[model samples]
Target: MRELDVAKLPEYVEEDVRVSEWSTVRVKHCAYSVPSRLKGKWVRVRIFEDKIEVRFADVIELACERLIGRNLCRIDYRHVIWSLIRKPGGFARYVYREEMFPSLVFREAYDGIQVLQAGTKGDLEYLRILHLAASTMEADVAVALSLLQMAGKAITSDAVKEMIASSSTSIDVPQLVSPAVRLSEYDALLTEVAA
Candidate 1:
C-alpha cells in the first residue's frame, strides 16, 4: 500500500474482518476510525507500511464483550468510524469523529486516586455523581468538584434538579432532559460520530 489522500483511502482499506471473544487487536500504525461497537472484540489486521484496514463490525463486537467488567481500558465499539492507533505510553486512546467523552477517563483516573484506592461507598458515590454531572453541557464542574471535597458525595439527578428548582443553593439547574445526548447538537464538534 502507498500513501494516499482521503479520496484514495477507501481503496487501501477493506471491511468485514472477524475475531474471537475476550481479545485485543493491535492497530499499531496510522489513524482511522473504527465502528464504536467494536470496543472489546479482537481484530486480526493485515497491514503494510502504507495502507491498513480493520474493516469489520463483528470483529469489534467480539473484542468488546471480552472486555466487559474490566477496569478502565480502552475499547472500541461499533460506531460509524472504527479506526484505532496504539499511542505512545501504551495508553490506547479510542479516536473517532464522535463519542468523545473524557468523563469516563476522568472517572477511571479518579478511582486511581490514592484516597479512593480502597474504594469506599462514598468515593464511588461522589465519583458517579461527578461523572454524570460533568458530562452535562450545563454542569458546573468546578462546583461539583468542590462539592465532592465538602463531603457532599452525590445528589441523584432528581434531587439535584429539585435543589436547583427549589433554589436550595445558588446553583441553577434547568428542567429535566434526556440523559442521552444527540451528537448533532454539540457546537464544538465538527464531525458527527455515534456512541
Candidate 2:
C-alpha cells in the first residue's frame, strides 16, 4: 500500500448556512449562536472536529466549540443581548434559556428576582440585570448581586443598576496635578551648546 499524504487534506470544511431568527446557525444538528445582526443572513461556517468558525462577508465573527449531540446548542449571551433588552419577556420561555445565564451567580440572581417579583415582571427584571452584566464587567454585577442578597434588599434591575453605579469610581480630570515644566531650561541648554 502506498503511504497516504495527510498534508493534502483540508484543515476544515466550509459550509454556507443562514442565521435563523433565533440568532443561531445550525451545523451537524447542533446550534451555535451568532450576532443577532446576522439573522436571516447567509454566513460561512467552518467545521472543525472540536469547534466551528463563523464568518460573515469574509470576516470571521465568531468561533465556538462544537456541540456533540443532536439538537444541542451553545449560546453566548452577548449575541442576543440587545434583542433581549428590547423584549425581555422571551427570557423565561426561550428554547435555550439556560444558556443565556453566564454563571451560577447570574442564575441565582434570576431566581432571587423571581422570588421577589413573580411572572413577567421578574423575567424583565432579570433581563435588565443580564443587560447590565453584558454592558459592564460581569464580576462587578455578580458582586453587586451578592451584596444585595446579603443586605436583604430587593434584587431588582434598578437596585443592581444603582449598586453598580455606586461601586464604580468617578475620576475628575481637573483634580489631577500636572508636573511643572520650565521652557527656560531648554533655552539655557541651547545657549550652552552654542557657546
Top model number, lDDT = 2
Q: 161-190, model 1: which lDDT tens digit per residue?
A: 444344446667889876987766684365
TM-score of 1: 0.29
TM-score of each: 0.29, 0.82
What's model 1's lDDT at 140?
Answer: 52
What is candidate 2's lDDT per residue for 1-195, written digit by digit as tens?
Answer: 998776666779999999999999999999899989999999999999888899999899898788899998888888898898788787778988999788888888888888988888888888888888888988989999999888988898888888888777564456778889999999999999999
Distance from true location, Cα of 131 in model 1, Å: 5.0
What are the per-model numbers of colliding residue pairs? Answer: 32, 0
lDDT of each: 0.38, 0.88
